[model samples]
Target: MWVLTQKINEREDKNFSRKCLLCRLQFKGCRADYLSHLSRLHNMQLGQPENLVFIDDLLNCIETRLESLHCLFCNKLFKNQTVLKEHMRKKQHKKINPKDTEFDKFYIINYLEMGKNWRQVKNEPDDDDDDDELSNAENSDRRVSVGNWSDWEEDEDKVENPVVCLFCERSSSFDEIQSHMNNAHGFDFTRISVDMDFYHQVKLVNYVRRQVYMGHCPYCDKILPNRRELLEHMSMESHFIVPQMQLWDQPEYFFPTYENDSFLCHLNDHQDDMAELHLSKKMEEDCHIGSC
Candidate 1:
């Protein structure tokens, strides 16, 4: 329950000696040394509130520290939860047997709870049967025995409106389209866009892509063959549009056109002025196209 922010170390001194609040033992050197002492000597239980508070405080005292988010299973560090979640999904971290390693057991439990909370926040259906099926799929040891890419291809072939990559015009299944867009076309869904249509397009693409990847309809729990089918089904169902707009829009998504070559050359030097100029140009183009 104790959420330690990334700024914990900023409050600590560089040459400061640490004293264990529990043992009252004064020690010199880094906070990690003291943490090791606490772990080795006291066998601090992270689950305990009192222990967590002490550990949290101890961690705050370190000048230099490891990355905030880390996966012990893969021995990797991530800058944030978003990056960590993507890594977990790609690596199939949830599919790994926790019983194989102590660290895996501890981390997997926490992550699963986090995932459940996220699903709840999204208002996803709470189906015990679906949960059990997923649990069984993950627990199975034989990875090769699971569903293959050929199954996805077959599903795509059956769909009347197959998902096609706009960038490269490649036909791909719903599950594989997003990865294909990222890896092949270098399409970044996270890009900032000023145009509302472009923004909505990005959101719709990601939303449908995720639903397809999960093998279910977002509006209805009905199973879909591929993302193409899901999109068509959603369209037939008349699912209301709920654009997943970003908190901050990026200006780079708009193609800037300048009235003068000099203005374009010095655009980076005067970002504010260039933004205003670009907006005016965009408005004029929009008006011209609308009149036509």
Candidate 2:
């Protein structure tokens, strides 16, 4: 899918940084620190810090809302600030609502994808998550290691940027991930692509990635309780196969299931080579006809 780059909305004042509007003079110097505080303390993430614009204004808006005894996530009004705080804490409503497009202006993606909101980009027919943190907060009952503020900052990057095997937790760099998938999981994406178009291959990979990540069997509806058991079930049941096209074929699959899995970027290059080969054969055929 071709994105019109020149048309993406422009953002400025990215250097703006000041004291946290919510906290008592915390995060006074760096915006990155401010963002970490929000994520760590409040569980609030207004998208990624790097992709944010007018962040101070965004925080001010949120603070104003809070000062009025309102919940940021639900936007529900309360009789007092103490009541609102309790409501947000009890309901786990510390973050902004993803469905609310009013907050879209604060994110750079809304501008970058030709003025399309990031949510819209996910929903667009050409490309898409239930990618919130709350559901998989503990990585589906994995042991939790409570860490310091710096550790908390590092954890988010690791979670979003992992290049782990689709069937297991083994990780490698982007260049090595495909090889790992093939060697470790017996899943060779390139070999499978000889019979399918690029987009179909994308979908198939996404289907498996999602199912296996969620601890479910991609070939069937059978669900496992966790990643460990799911791996065993798939291996023992011999149930790895392309799922129903209707299930996996989606625009959202065009996106990497993992944020930094640059293997998805490699698929574009793979398709280009096939197209080049086809063009070369056609050119040779034309040359022979001309000589004749």
* TM-score versus the correct structure, for each prediction: 0.21, 0.40
lDDT of each: 0.42, 0.64
Candidate 1 clash figure, as a count: 0
Deviation of model 1 at 228, angstroms: 13
lDDT of 1 at 35: 54
For model 2 the local lDDT of residue 223 reads 91
Give the alpha carbon lDDT tens digit for every residue of 16-90 in model 1: 486652233577765455555444333332332222223344344221222355542354776544454345434
| Off by more than 4 A, model 1 | 1-68, 79-86, 94-99, 103-203, 206-292
1-292, model 2: which lDDT tens digit per residue?
A: 1222321222222343565544333344456666765554344556676777666677888888988878999899975554565576545577778787778777667776665677777775531245434467567454355435678776544533345666777765444776887776667766767667656766677778778777779988699999778877877876655667888888877555665443443332245446656766787789999999
What value does the lDDT take at residue 80 in candidate 2? Answer: 56
Best by lDDT: 2
On the 0 to 100 scale, the lDDT of residue 112 in model 2 is 65
